[model samples]
Target: MGNINKDNLLYMAKYSAFNPYRMREREMGYTTSIGSSDALAKSLYCGMKAIATWDSDREKAPPTGGIFNLEFSPEGTLLVAACEKKSIQIFDPLTHERIHAVNGAHTDCVNCVKFLDARMFATCSDDTTIALWDVRNLKKKIRTLLGHSKWVKNIEFSVKDKLLVTSGLDGSIYTWDINSYTEYNLVYQRVFHTSSLMRCRLSPDARQMVLCTTGGLIVIIHDLNLATLAQDLHGFKPNLYRLMQMSHQMIPVAAMYDHLFDSKNRENRVEFVSDFPEGNDAEVVSALQVHPQGWSALSRNISHDDKSEWTCIHDIQPMESPCDKDTRDTSPVGRGRRTPSRRTRPRVYRVPRPMHPNPMATTHIQITRESERAAAGPSTSHQGGAPISPPQPSRLGLPGIQNDVWEAAITIKQHRLLQEMYNRGADVPSTSGYTPHQESPYTSDEEPAAKHFIRQNKNRLLYYIEETNEGKGFIKELCYSSDGRIVCSPFGRGMRLLALNSDCGELSGVAQDLSQPRLMVELGQSLGIHTDLVVSSKFSPRYHMLVTGCLEGKIVWYQPFSGESL
Candidate 1:
């Protein structure tokens, strides 16, 4: 038994390309690289349970027809399993007590299992159908989904839990409104290709769905509410009556831009004005503005579209360069790609534009600097030619010009405030130099050393990186409690738990190992210094206590706190 944070393990997979050493260790099946400590064991070892992964030598010389799919329920109590044994088994997760068994549920092998709710569960099989069952009344069958003409490969419930989608060997995806069990009454179904749909998922909001096909094409489907379409089409439904009938039309845009800005300004002299608009050079708007006086707008003096016959539209003076930070400038709140849905969350994004060239080279500012005003200039004189008192300069450095003048929309004060924050380490880049740190999971390295890439906040290291791996695999399943008191590393192969050593800001060294540590799915909750998790064997979602599931289709339930294998 060894203890280690699951994040560290997933980190290894994420940065495997960059950090060859750590990845090599992972490939060599090195579990518990962080070393074992008693404190970690006591904290993480809530109970014992069965677990499983793909047989290491599945396609090798010695082929063992064993278990493949393994999962635990949302409550982490019961484990549900589909194994090569062609049977589903139930047992005490901690004590390994054999509770019940369903021998030969399918002609071939069981593929996967999912909990519909707390009491109902669903299982798919190589037999090409999904069977819904009432787990509490195991002898009865709730329903059987039979749309797939071939073996069903996967199934998932919608976010709202009203719809269930399934894909399989037939290269088609089918969605069913569970409440309306009619076969032809399918809500949505599409034949993607001759190849199978390997996986699919509904978005968190249930507005859209995505599909990953074996043919390598990612298909996106837009679902429309019939009521909304009816209202827009005929106006029969009033007061939001047509929302349920509306259809979404996808339109392609050639270009898009976003800009975000803080309302506060600290710089007095220099400021940001506006962004350039889209168009040919002939009609391109070179300047933009946020000012009321129109002093920040830029109008080109000459049109460059006709090289032979140049025309001046307008011109102005130039100043220092502007600040550039991608996070504050370009990126949205969530990393997800945005769509044109009005219901989507509103965000502030900055539209980027090129800075002006040196206005010193221009004759406008050059003339003012060397004009007679540079010498005697003009004095405050009355009609009698008698010198009068000159008023103090305006707080803003706007010069008095007879014709017109262009100034930054951002005041000098705003620019100065941003600079102050930059100098004070308010927003700093993680890496200082040109080193290409691991910013992506697909990069050829494990996560970069925490010191080089992560932001340290007192006792915690926080960062988010993307992964190229398919559906919530090894690293994707892990999550931490807000207080950092518990760690759940639910890998596709297995799950691990670790205790947070609050005093040392390090992980304790004790751990518990199941048969297939890689197949365990983990989740945790914290009450105090203790965070509890339930591990189950196979696909059993029901757990009265500490339950476990094995990839071989076995499950167990026990009382981990009392050390009783019930």
Candidate 2:
């Protein structure tokens, strides 16, 4: 009877399991719904002719080339797109008119396009140099930036109008000066990854530049906009003490999606650690800059704390937290919380007993199993879960697992020191080593840096211009007047302008019938008028107006903000 039961159990197990191909189909739900693979295949076959004919319509591109780079002006009016094509284009978004076009722009495909101002723009290409174009006159190139030995992938402008940033496939980024027409002494040339860099962008204020490279890595060029510090350091300080001082107390506070565990889906684990020790403090930084080496958090001292306690509160996304192989939760870990498998002595940071009764600072560590294996190699996790392949730490002198643990200890010490100082009065000895304006020497600017910030009133503007309708059919551009007095948006197939804060909300309206409004820009009163420019994705910035230079070398400037005409 026992043997028969065993045989029957084996038979059932064998019948229930699926092959690799079937498993993939089941996991992806290949043909389970209307938008399934089967449906996609049918749609592709049905629209074969349309797809072939409209394939060159750069406005509507498929994911084969991926989203190389995207940029929108602060006013959200001008949009620049650089893709696999060796050209740069701009457009009047509201009227759906192509504004400027530069063909044969590069020997290889243009990787990035950035507007330097109304007349000038910069583009990087696979041919190893950045081309500065006089978009005002699309007939000639203004200047050719030659330095990078590999494909120049991205370019950006600094806030002070002093520098031009360009990153290339060589894993190096160079900063150049417009006036000198020569390479600046500053170069954030770090070989962060074995693979080539794909994209790079400057922080709104241009303080730092972030690069996304091959191997799914990101690198943050610290002090790129060091208004004061730029006069000092030539390269990274690599302060081990500072890195150690910031390893603990920093933990992942947000929620991420998990592919496994919950059959109904929508679950993730919290990964917390001290910010990556790349020699940055919170005072000079306001947010965690995600990069290939790791993410960064700013540690600014609170003004109210007479003790000058460090009170910087910043966070970075996609932290690197590889857990031990034996660390899975039997019971589910709720959103934003984790049930750590077990606490070990080595992983815990020992704090001074004077600070707290127990004294040991407990650092919470959690690692989620990725659906796709990491490219770096096999890594371990704590959840006695399925074995996962994670990128291994480079054998070459990089910080090891032990170093991370030690750094965690130092982070706890720094936090405790800051907490103690906060408790003490401003006149205390801890504040003796520092003066009110000793270390930092700068006044708060009237116009804060150009970057994302949490608005206290919530009545402010937020710029969001992601690829819309998926597969790049169109891009949505939005801009709300400073006081929300007016709102303009390019919705599906039309441009919508409304009186958001008007009393009657019946302010004159118009909808330009179009497939999509790809870009929007407001020159502000800086343009000497209270008018805005809306251009298509293919248009380029020229003179004071937005003009479209099409494939036939035709220039067309669509007038959408002409209220009198409407």
Candidate 3:
């Protein structure tokens, strides 16, 4: 790393392509790479400059609505996208050139494109139709799937059962057998029946699926199966007003995001800021994609104020179960554990000398000794020849022919006695005679039950990242690479290449704290690349290049780190 410098720029460019955090480590002065990163770093801070590229302004084509979604081939060679122009566009991912185009493939805008395999892909459109296409022949569709009544929103493929699941605006979830295109799709009906449904996505691990709707409602189907949605299973509702309105039959961890229905200051409510002007409803999470590792999710927020578009990385961590360490602490003042021992009681600490020493009280004590000379006799003195001082009564007020201690001696003694009793009470076990750490079904212990409740109900927050750009345009898309090193998100008309500014993690994508996202490159609109709002973008899973689509029918491919034309 130290050998590669400005003098050897050619060598650095040749080998640094595979380095995941090349620009990030160069700026941060740290890396998982070998040697000191600062030695190999550049002296001048020319960070994230827009790379110069030749983009023609007169490049105009037909059916120019915009790209709705982008999907990469399983082999990472071709890129296909759903377009609002009612066509399917395919491109060579290595270059920015369009290899083939399917015009008038759908009656309405294509909403989503998903590759089934290397040679096959599926697409859904606003015309309520799903088409299966073959890469060998891009001229026509292999099969046209027609079952949805309204606009189809999303398409999910289950590799285990070889099924294609799709959801639509008509409030229906259908699963088609990909093995047999002639078979009719099965509509699984249970708790999910709403026209407000926006999109549903299966988790990367395929263990569960989350459904996001227009009413700020996010329903999760746990242990997801085709028959799981049709089963009559009871759901567990947490303590959140208007957030857990379940159908009472489906097992859903439901939570609402709308402030109009939810309490203004609800504790532990995981929701995004809403900006939609719709009537008492907002699609807070405009874009949602689970991390490929399946531990967390990446969500893009919808905002009317373009600059306030926030992106968050939510991690799903399992809550810790009840443990004995909490009940094993030994502190006495304020602790749960109760060990009955007073080795350092008040007696261990001596009370201070009285503030006001009375000389007349001392003289009176000497005079009383002479008066009781005959009364004391020989038995007054102890066996060791030391005379004992009798306990004084509270009735002996100041100057009552007795020892008159001035610093409220009676009150001090009473306080010590009360403290001892309070200590004993704290050590006392429950009526069932079980220790606090011991489990007792009949005992009144709410702590253990509360812990179990929290374990089941709580969703641990991993990290949150927000965009504070006070400029125009919102982030309509976020593309996370399959290699799990970078997260590409669009800001305004431009696009930003962001990486998790945390520890080096190659295996788990979103497992670390991603609160602080570092931007490596900015392909700004002023750079003569994407001149319009970047509505959709995709990262080459194996390569370090990114392709973005804008509203103006202009497509730009960029190298994520150097911001160069691909």
- Top-TM-score structure, candidate number: 3
lDDT of 3 by residue, 77-110 (tens): 9988777778887877776567777889898778
Pick out the ten consecutive residues of candidate 2 with the lowest summed lDDT. 361-370
Error (Å) of candidate 2 at residue 243 is 11
Off by over 4 Å in 3: 1-61, 181-191, 232-283, 303-307, 317-459, 468-475, 502-528, 560-566
**Which wins on TM-score, candidate 2 or candidate 3?**
3
Q: What Cα-based lDDT does every candidate model obtain?
A: 0.33, 0.34, 0.48
Comparing 1 and 3 on lDDT, the stronger one: 3
Give one clash count per candidate, in the order shown: 88, 58, 1
Q: Compose the digit string of candidate 2's lDDT tens values, residues 33-69.
A: 3213222222221221100101133454232121233
TM per candidate: 0.35, 0.35, 0.57
Task: Name the regions of candidate 2 deviating beyond 4 angstroms.
Answer: 1-80, 182-199, 208-566
lDDT of 3 at 421: 45
The TM-score of candidate 2 is 0.35
Give candidate 3's root-mean-square deviation (CA, Å): 28.6
